[model samples]
Target: MKGLVYKGNNTVKLQEEPMPKVEAPTDAVIRMTKTTICGSDLHIQRGHVPTVPVGRILGHEGVGVIEEVGPSVKSFKKGDKVLITAISSCAACGYCRRGMNSHCHTGGWMLGNTLGGTQAEYVKVAHADSSLYALPAGVDEGALVMLSDIFPTGLECGVICSKVQPGSTVVIVGAGPVGLAALITSQLYSPSQIIVIDMDENRLSVARDLGAHHTINNASGVAEAAAAVLKLTDGIGCDSVIEAVGVPASFELCQKIIAPGGMLANVGVHGASASLHLEDLWHHNIGITMGLVDTVTVPMLLKLVAAKRLDPSKLITHRFKFADMEKAYATFGDAAKHKALKVLIEYD
Candidate 1:
């Protein structure tokens, strides 16, 4: 077996590795079908996520087929096509009982740094019954790959956390895969207006096609961008704002554009310290919430995909083979940062 190993300081290498086996009673062995490089992966590669260990098999989002099941795994059997939830959880925990699987008492993401991840030919899935979702028959790998992370992440952060509703005005900062997924999912609420902000025009165009009512290239100045958004809202602020970039500037933009009493969902993973204007947020009475997205909403997202109400495939603009994992990393990690959206690393 081969996996992409993080070599540290913005480096990745493809190396032959031993295949994974069931390590726990609740574990399952998955044959990787489609795995992907996420913006978060870039964070780890760039040394932003210092917690990630060196030589770690680096990947989280995966769609695969169950090759073997542990003794206690009951919900799935070998040969079941499944989506690996990025966040690993013990479904029996108190937090999980409250639908906060990302914060399960057991752990989230037993793979990757903590263990071997889905970047290889096979991966050990911990708490399989709770973490893996069976994919619907006939769904292609391209469409379901993101369910493991990006899609569900966006839907949870952009749609659920923001509490988007019909006739509500919303602003989403960032146009990356997760941000674009947010753009698409935000439409489900039939929001009267959806504004997408990004420095990339290509991404903003995709956001527009995905149902954003307006798009802004926040390249010049924040005040200018905020003014444009304000004008669109008839001088009022948007009802909900989603900060998807995980950067200080984008998070501040979310706060700046939010309407009084609006809800602000910070979906980005902050890699560095970010300062906030507490006085402004306090005066506006804005509600702020942030979290690692749990897989609780995956079932609903799967239904939407099955019903054809949502199409996540539009964002997968690049593909790679497992053997070409190095190239995939280089392309996604650098070259395609601006041009490509989601890059899938395929396996048998």
Candidate 2:
């Protein structure tokens, strides 16, 4: 079977590899039908994730059909359509019991990180019953694939963690896929103001259409951007500032725009260290929080999608065949030039 594998030295390759089988009593093998690369994949390629070794499969989000199930599996079987989860968890673990599945002792974030991921013809999912979502009849697999990571990440980390309240002002720094995902989900809380900030005018335009009350481009400088944000909020900072871009500048911008007693929720996966201005922030009584998605909201999000309250498919701007995955990577990597949000890789 053909699989996209990380070959180290900031690269990936589509290579022929052996098919995966059940590795444990709790595992299941699924044939991938559709998948997409993530921002995190780019992070891995750029040597951001040191734990990922060479030759590891490069994805964790997708939709697939069960080809086989281990003896212990009961919620799904052969022929079931499933949504692959990026974060794997053993539901019975202590961390999982507390709704912190991202830190599950045996299975947190194994897929596409510490284990072979979904960017291939087949993938063996550990803790299969807990790590996969059963597709409802007539749901679009392409959109469901987005929920496997971006939506949950946005909803759980950005929206909920930041405690976005109705009638409050919120600012999201960065309009990339994850930032847009956070923009989309943040509306659930009915924030009176949603300021979408980025360096890309194209993404800022998309963010405007997606429900941002204001958009700021950092083309000049963060100082100018901060001035613009304060102008919108009547010279006061935002009630909540969500950092969706993991870079030092974006994070620092979040600090600059956040209001006193506000929340700063960071949803980006940082590959480098960022400084915290505690001297400036200490007197403000602000709350700063960061986390990996526990994905406990997947069920509710599924219902929202089924009801047409959410449409993740609108985020898809490109598509490629499984064989064109390397090309897909190139396009996704050059998002600003390609005007890409998410690229779906359709299998033969």
Candidate 3:
């Protein structure tokens, strides 16, 4: 088998690798049908995620058919079409009991991070019963691929954490895939405004088409963007500000735009330290929250996709065959140049 590998020092390579087999009673071996590179993969490739071992298979989002299941796996059988969640969870753990699957005792985000990932023809999934979702009939694979990470991630870590309320002003920093996911899901709360900010005008255009009430291009600088955000909110700032871009500048913009008593929800997987101006925030009574994705909302998201209420396909701006994954990575890694949102890597 061949898998996308992180070769350390800001590099990625496609290499031939041994096939995976069920490693535990709770595991399942999946034949990767469709996968996509994640923003975190870029973090790992750049050595931002230092814990990722060299030569690790690097992907955790995909949809596939179950090739085999361990003895303990009961909810799924061989040949079941499934959505592979990025995070693995032992449903029996204390964290899992609290719906915090991202911190499951035996398995939490092990795929592509601590273990082999879905960037190959076959990869092993731990705690299969809790981590894999059986694809609903007629469900779009491309949409399910989005469900594997960004949707639930954006909803959980962004919208839910921000405490978005009806008629509240919401500003999301970053118009990347997860940012757009938050833009899409934030509509559910009927926020009076959905403002999206980014450096890329193309992405901001996409954000507008996908329902953002306003879009700002900060290519000039943050000072300009902050002024624009304040102007949009009539100098009050936003009620909910979501930081979906992992860079410090974007996170700082999120902090700047949040109103008094507003929530700043961080969905970005930061690789560096960003300052928190606590002195300025303490007097404002603001709230801040961040976390790894738990993906507990996948089932409900599945129903929305099935009902055609949420079209995850809007985020997929490019596609490639599994053989062309290298090129796909290049395209995704340089998303701005390619004007790419999500690049779907699939098997024929």
Candidate 4:
């Protein structure tokens, strides 16, 4: 088998590797059919995620067929098509019972981090029953790839955590995939205004096509962006502010634009410390939330996709073959240059 291996000092290569087999009672080995690059993968390559050691396979989002299953695995078997979840969870754990599967004691986010991931021909999945979703018949596998991470992250962390409500004003401070995912799901609540901010005009245009009521290019600076948002909100801030860009400046913009008593949901994965302006926010009763995506909403999101209420496939801006994994990474890494969003990599 061949897999993309991360080398130290921000490098990766597609190299020959041994195939994975079911190693645990609850494990299953998946033969990947489709996969995609994520912003987090870029973070890992940039040495932002220190826990990811070199020589690790580098991907968490994929759709595949079951090649083998351990004796204890019951929900799926060989030949079943499944969506590999980014976060692996043992449903029996305390955190899992509390619906915080991202922190599941035994298996949280093991794939593509602490364990081998889905970028290869075969990848081992721990907590198989809780970590993989059975594919519905006739659904687009490439689109289902989005459910493996971004959609659930956007819905759970960005939309739900921020408490987007009907008729409320919402602002998402990034036009990246996750930010667009948040923009897509936030509409389920019928927010009166869905404003998306990003420095990239191409992404902002894409956001508009995907239902963002307004788009702001932050190239002029955060103050100008905040002033524009305030003008849109009639001098008030948004009822919910989602910080989808995992950077200090983006987070600061979220702080400046959140309405008093509103929620600020930080959906981006931050590799560095970001300051929280407590002195400035002391009078604003705002709630701030951030965490890894639990993916508990995969089932509901599947139903929504089946109903045609959501179309994550629209986020797919580029495609590649398994042989083009390195090229795919290059395209996704310089996303602004490529005008890319989600870059899907299909297996031969």
lDDT of 4: 0.92
Task: Supply candidate 3's per-residue lDDT for 1.
Answer: 93
How far off is residue 344 in model 3, in Å? 0.3
Give the per-residue lDDT of model 3 (tens digit) for 216-262.
Answer: 99988888999999999999899999999888998888878899999
lDDT string for model 2 (206-234, tens) is 99999999899888988999999999999
Which pairs clash in model 1? 88-109
Q: Which stretches of candidate 4 lie over 4 Å from their true place?
A: none
TM-score of each: 0.97, 0.98, 0.97, 0.98
TM-score result, candidate 3: 0.97
Tens-place lDDT digits, model 1, residues 1-348: 888888897888889888888878989999988898888778778887767899888888888889999899999999999999889888898999998888888868566757788888888889999899889877777788878888888889677888889999999999989888888888888899999999988888888888888899999978889889989988878998988988888887777799987899999988777788897778887788889888788999888888888888898888888899888877876633648888878775
Q: Which candidate, 2 or 4, would have the higher lDDT against the true structure?
A: 4
Where does candidate 4 clash, by residue pair?
A: none
Stretches off by above 4 angstroms in model 2 are: none
Which TM-score value belongs to model 1?
Answer: 0.97
**For model 1, what is the alpha-carbon lDDT of residue 301?**
87
- Over the stretch 1-348, how does candidate 4's per-residue lDDT look in tens digits? 999988878788899998987888999999999999989888889888889999999899999999999999999999999999899999998899999999999988888899988889889999999999998887888889999999999999999999999999999999999999999999999999999999999999999999898999999998999999999999889999999998898998999999999999998877678889999999999999998899999999988887888889999999999999999999999999999999999987
Q: Give the backbone clash total of model 2.
A: 0
Each candidate's clash count: 1, 0, 0, 0
Following a full C-alpha superposition, what root-mean-square deviation does model 2 have from the true structure?
A: 1.0
